[model samples]
Target: MAATEHLLRQGSFPAFFGIVAIATLVIRYLYPDLFSQSPISKLPYVGTHVGLPIQKKISFMTNARKLLRDGYRKFHIYRTETALGQCVFLSRDSMVELLKKPDEVINFEKVVIKDFECKLTKLASSEPIVPHTIRSDLTPGLVRIIPRVAIEVARTIDNELPATDSWTAHNIYDKLLRIVAISAGSAFLGPESCHSEEWIQSAVGYTIDVVTGAVILKLFPSFLRPLAAKFVPAIKRVDRHRAGISRMMVPIIRERKEKANTPGYEKPDDMLQWMLDKAPEYGIENDEEMAYVQLGVGLVSIHSTTSTATQALYDLAARPEYFQPLRDEIAKALQESGGDFTKDSLYSCKLLDSFMKESQRMSPISMVIGKRILEEDVQLSNGVFLPKGTLVASPAEAVGNDPAHFENPDEFDGYRFYRLRQKGGLQGNLNQMVTANKQNLAFGYGKHACPGRFFAVAEIKLIVAHILLNYDIELADKSVGRYPNKFHGDACTPDTSKQLLFRKRLSGQSEI
Candidate 1:
């Protein structure tokens, strides 16, 4: 009461309210939720959170997996500091209940906005149009573009890799990145744009730049980030790429618009065309907005597909015994589909699908899944309460490796899912690369599960099928098996620096 009287005597009511308003804004920026009001604050915290907040944040940034694993072991639900803010990590049992909640209560887009700094980077809007394009058009159009995707993948491989009888070591990650960029680009930007070096670089560069810029901007104080973003090299590069992409895209968009009603006009079946068709419905008005959406699509698709494909390749090379079987399966599937690599042929290659799924299972993308930021209060089935503004996720990596769910989970069984599929029940449907369930959260789970995954999985299969049919791959260092994945915080990515030896096969396997 004395302190309250002292504060009142210090300034006018307007001044006091102004100071309180500024403090409220600052606290909201620093903390994801109100420390005194949030239910998460009542839960056990994984790391120190009271004092030394910066140190806690640094520890969380560097040792996220360790902290997460510790939290998973110790608590049913726990709070942990992140680079962004505090997040609540849930146990495996609670994931189903959390995932079942509607977007209005536990929102996915809100989490993405906070995590990706979408508003600052100008990479995405709260309600993005790309997901609609991917689900409604891109995935459906795969049947028409499988042949084109095959051609692009083949061309990229031939151009980037040597077709020599003798083994040549190459950075397989870089090679696959290029292959995915061009192939995925063909769908996102059309064939002509994919051919341009400037566009490909911009597409690839934008993803890198945005990530780099986000990381750099995150290091600054929230109030200073706007100023920091203006001077950061990576942030500047992102703008250049964005402007260049808009310049290149505007003309093509205009041309397509002009030719829309021509008597003999044939609209291209690609993401750009599909996106343009859906843009108006999503409040995307100008060419610049269209370009941003296209780049946003590229950002998610290219890097993820490339990393998954690279990981699969590393696994295939490490365990060479699976190669011939995958090759034979691809050959059989292609022959069954009348000598063309179509949707049917890709789907028919069950062993390949299993192998990809297993590769993903062993080295899943991130440690957590079903990331959400609650917009309204949520109560899990277990009666755990999450207040509005709470960030939440499940321990995905632990769940994937749990022996209770997977038999001999530690062993990297390439045919794990294939054998499950052979059981001829619900397991068959659940064990695919693209299936995102409680068990498989590599692509996340529920309504927010990656919409572009079907196309991504198809592209990955196509690239791997082509590689198996045309080349022999092995680790450059014969003693080293699969290169270990590199981790930064909760994220896991293929070792980009590792090289794999590739040589052309003695006899050309038929084109997949």
Candidate 2:
């Protein structure tokens, strides 16, 4: 009678309800087919299913690489549940199969926009003006862009890095990210605004805010997300950045519009002009909307470019053996182009290209690329049925490291692609860092593959070339190998906290 009284006292009515609530969630997680009504319940998920949602999410976030490899090895197609919901992972061989499907069947933009939580964050709605402008105007205008971007890159490098022959500790990721943002600002925002500290802050802050806000908002229940978005610091900061961008861009957009058709007016050569030129057909009616579109574009470009460049630098520093050859390639390219880093000159640095590609293969931006949300239920050629509203992706990282795709894939052979290029013909064409084949998904694949990849490759090459030409870099802690990568979910990024030792090259070729 005394023991029963103690048990009853410990398990009060409130505690009982709490226990019951947790038990229900656990049961739902464990026996999804019976307890959950979601369509994706039937799909096989990565990791153990007999845990609470938070535990599964934690595993997904922290151990994505291991889970991805295990899933890729065991099943042809499977799902992984995270804060983003259940994302179905397809084998690397599914690239060709996915390529056969039109955007109508497997939508790309929808997944991106959803992941960004554009509705709550007010980051950007669907805007064709961004990609359309990038594809049509910005790409063909690389002749103009390469020179302008190079100028900012040179200037930013000089400004951000200390001029010293002695080794100096620097947070290379922050320096590199800042350099990328400021330099990309020139091509994306224009020369007038690129130097503005306000624009740079807004551009960089907005990308971070969108990501932070989305992650935060995902933590709340769907019904409470709207309220949470209003109060969330990052979500609120996103609006501030959006408003500032509008204030900065409206007058410029208006001026561009007014001068657009004037007889003697030569349009400004930048992404803003390109977007404004193509806005009407894409239904971009207001100046503010155009500014948001620019933010959206910056969001896509800056982070990936920064991460790619950072990883390549880390790799170069860790394996300092590649430095002399890369420097030689840069020097040769510069000499051939009369010391200007043009599109052709940058592309001609095939060794640097190979190095960056190798770096990317070893550490891609994400374990899985070609992420898409299904528009309608579809079956793969191998007869894997995917339901509508299911998220899907290809295991590009696994493919990059696969022996069948790359010989001795685990080894960081910087000259791998460069040597492959010497083989000539179709193999050489596909080996280019910008070219996205089944084996190379750094820029993804199919019609929806990164439109900015050509520019991205150029930008990465330009930055790396400048660094090689200007500075000798290595891990700040001389004893360390490549700084460890920070993984969150499927995303793999170079560690920003680790510092690198940068010493100005005393006798290097002139800056690009």
In order, what is each prediction's RMSD in angstroms? Answer: 5.2, 4.3
Model 1 pairs whose backbones collide: none
Estimate the lDDT of model 1: 0.82
Please provide, for model 1 over 405-455, each residue's C-alpha lDDT reduced to its tens digit, 9 standing for 90 to 100. 889988999889999999978988888888878768788777868999999
lDDT of 2 by residue, 21-72 (tens): 9978767767665776665566667785666667777788888888888787
Which residue segments of model 1 deviate by more than 4 Å? Answer: 1-37, 48-51, 508-512
After TM-score superposition, the amount by which residue 444's alpha carbon in candidate 1 deviates from its true location, in angstroms, is: 2.2
Candidate that scores best on TM-score: 2
Model 2: colliding residue pairs: none
